[model samples]
Target: MSSPLVFIDGDQGTAGLQIHERLRGRTDLTLMTLPATERKDVRRRAEAINACDIAILCLPDRAAREAVGAIVNPAVRVIDASSAHRTQADWTYGFPEMTPGQAERIATARRVTNPGCYPTGAIGLLRPLLDAGLVPENHPVSIHAVSGYSGRGRAGVEEHEGPGAVGAPSFQVYGLELAHKHTPEIQRYAGLARRPIFVPAYGSFRQGIVLTVPLDVRMLAPHADAAALHACLARHYAAAAHVHVLPLHQPGDLKHLDPQALNGTDDMRLSVFSNMEQGHVLLSAVFDNLGKGAAGAAVQNLNLMLAQ
Candidate 1:
């Protein structure tokens, strides 16, 4: 049998570059990328996309949509790494460890939408709680997170590390409009009845994410406490290979988190902190934004698709 031809539609951007880098050493399939000179040639791109067994889109929303529309081949399956199709009903969400059987669904899907980097962390923290009913759907929730500048893509890299680079800032925050593109994706996938106020920021580093969501245990089902919350998360993720729940914080122990802790791997860590007397708790997820949040996720989904 012939090796499957896999094409990357936006091989020059941040997510695209990482996906390419990770796949470079693979020997199982044939990889395809348009030459730099033809990257923007619509006819050539469309023809190349139609020729592959599967296409992984790492382009902006509009371009990803255009590429999807240009596919005339009946056999072409797609994995979109843009926010464009994430909320669309027809597309399978591409986070495998997210829910039971999600990986199987991705394997069988013809159209899969990669989760946003921020949502990968946020939803990873929220979904299980929502599903376990530890957090009510109507509960007003707020999320705060910081990712390395690579969240901004090529421009971010250029500003932080390019030849013309300005020194990376120690810290920065954005999405003040309260309408970040990842909000809806997070809300919908996390199963929240109301919209969440997501406060996202960037740090001087290049790639990693630490997302936090604060909740009031008083808002949970009657008699709920920190241990209940922790048990729920632990139960839900116990069998998951890549996602984990850390041991609860020790009494009067260290109270800090470093975003760069898991910078280079696809694994993720989830931790729960709470004050039982006050009915308050904090949930955290840490992972490589460029790894699990973007390229690593795309590659993981690609493997599922290929296995089927």
Candidate 2:
């Protein structure tokens, strides 16, 4: 059979550019693109979408939706790297290692929605615990995460790295309005009945993220301890190709957790830090916002879909 033809819908944007770069030189797929003059032409865009064996969408939520509406060929599968369709029933959530058979689901899905950066870490930490029944569905969970400025995409990059940029703080927190786009995906996929309290922040750098969730151990079922929670997470991700669980024995001496530790690679590291005496535990996940969180993930899902 011939190599599969793949089209990237928004190939000029930050995430789309990264996806295009990652797919460069791949022997199994052919990358298709339209000329700049025809980039916005609806007919040209629709034809490209329909002609591909797989289409990866890295546009804004609205544009991604519009691109999907233009696809007339049912054979062209899609892997969307936007906030759109994340909660839709017919679309498969694109975190392949989410469960035992999730990879297969992504491979066979006609439409797959890539998980957001924040939700990638949040769901990675919470899903196993919730599935093991250590945390109830109605539990009040709060996630505190910090990302590099690249998480803001092109405009954020221009604001921070541009020559005339002004008033850029070393670190800042947002989402104070309490309604972040990733909350619904986190809540839905993590098996939480109530919405989570999500607080996100951005730093001076370009990429990577650190998502931390604090939990009170005493409130857990059967009075579980910190080690139990660690074991649950470690076991769930033991076989995963990208997610890694750090050992719990090395505590106190460890200095700090850097958000940019995994900037260029498509890997996520999860660690559990606990103070049983204080009855608290902090679960942390570190990854590249543009890698495992976005473009790398989209590529992974595309590989799965094409394999099918």
Candidate 3:
């Protein structure tokens, strides 16, 4: 008749710290963490993980995997906030609003993989269209996203805000090698047959993301058009609590979208903009990367896990 014990594996990192802050002072469960000296102790870390009712992993891909490998207790459910298990077959994806009954799946899942920040936006836009045959499976998709410097995680936070750091670039595009880690995640989850081009940039601001994917209406199916695309997205997220698709043909939609608009919350907004004369449609998603993208997502999954 006691509260559940929750452990955060890498509480020093940005995502972990944020998760801790969100869960702090809550009387529902006990938050557990290792001291700095014992943080790297393998056996101690394993003990902490296996002892918790839930373990939220906010470590790097490698460390996250290792932490998962060390869990011997079947009761210790996990919500990994890393790229390590996103594509894994056995782990349930932790985007509760992603699809129908996805929240129930997260509620019962023993191994839930928290989604990457970029894939959250891309998949949110593409999944419904692909499933409805609006967009072909083999469509060569291209995603361009601008996230605040915090998207880079702790390193980015340091580069932009650390005491030793100064004069951080105003904006910078990365993943020039065309091999970003989020590429496979986006392609796989978005159900695209061909590899998509993802160009992600970092702005000088702290949190939020603006991800845009453009489509050629002419290249789509016979009846597929901008309106149809918008309807598909709107229908998909109509009942969703955290993800909302803006109405089509808004008078001044451009004036409303700012990356930092949803900074403190865990909701995401998807908007479709098009020029009928030009045959080009741009789909964009705006949200707090650290919220819907990382920490808030983990906490949501944990809440689901505890509710059941």
Candidate 4:
């Protein structure tokens, strides 16, 4: 049989460009993309999506929805890199290590929704603890994350690096309204009964993210401590190739975490730092926002779907 055709729609944006780079020169599948002139032609775009065996969409939420709606081929599968379908029941979430059998679910799914960059970190840290019942469902959870400017896509790049851009701030925190889109995804996948407070920030760097969720030991399930939380996450991701659970930190063992440490790579590191005397525990995830958070994740889900 001929090689399966893979189409990347909207490959001009930041996420799209990175995904194209990662999948370029592959021998297993036939890569396809429309000429720049025809990229926005609705008919042409629809045709390209339907012609491929698998379509990877890296577009804005509305455009991603439109692309999926235009698919007329019954055999065409999709991996959407937008927030459009993440909370939808019919779409399979594409975080392979989120839980047992999640990878298999993506492999067999016809429509898969790539998790948001921030949600990827938040859910990665929260899911296992919630699943193990070490944390109460109604605990007041607050998440804080800082990501490279690339998380804002091409616009951010232009603001920080383009000509005539000279006075951009070094750091800025957003989502002050408490209605950030990733909140729902984190709550649902992390299995929380109540909504959590999510605050995200953008740094001047090109890519990477450090997302942290602080917890109060006194509010957790009885007998649950920092060690139990660490062990639970360690056990959950024991066999996961992409997700790493770092050793629990002791006093004076580690001082700080650099968000850009994982730039250019798809691996994500999860760290648990605690102060028992103060009854405080902090969970953090470090990864390239453009890699594991976006393009890397889309490529990952694409690989799983291709294995079917």
The top-ranked prediction according to TM-score is: 4
**Which TM-score value belongs to model 3?**
0.97
| Segments of candidate 4 deviating more than 4 angstroms | none
Per-residue lDDT of candidate 1, residues 202-305 (tens digit): 99998889999988887787755778778888988899877889988655574688888998888889998877777678899999999999999999999999
Question: TM-score ranking from best to worst?
Answer: 4, 2, 1, 3
Q: What TM-score, computed on C-alpha atoms, does each candidate reach?
A: 0.97, 0.98, 0.97, 0.99
Pairwise TM-score winner, candidates 1 and 2:
2
TM-score of model 1 relative to the true fold?
0.97
Candidate 2: stretches off by over 4 Å: none
Best by lDDT: 4
Better of 1 and 3 by lDDT: 3
Residue-wise C-alpha lDDT for candidate 3, range 231-301, written one tens digit per residue = 99888888888899888865454665699989999999998988878888889999999999899899999
Ranking by lDDT: 4, 3, 2, 1
* Candidate 3 pairs with clashing backbones: none
lDDT of each: 0.91, 0.91, 0.92, 0.93
Cα miss at 101, model 1 (Å)?
A: 1.3
Give the poorly placed runs of model 3, Cα more than 4 Å off. Answer: 250-253
Q: Where is model 1 more than 4 Å wrong at Cα?
A: none
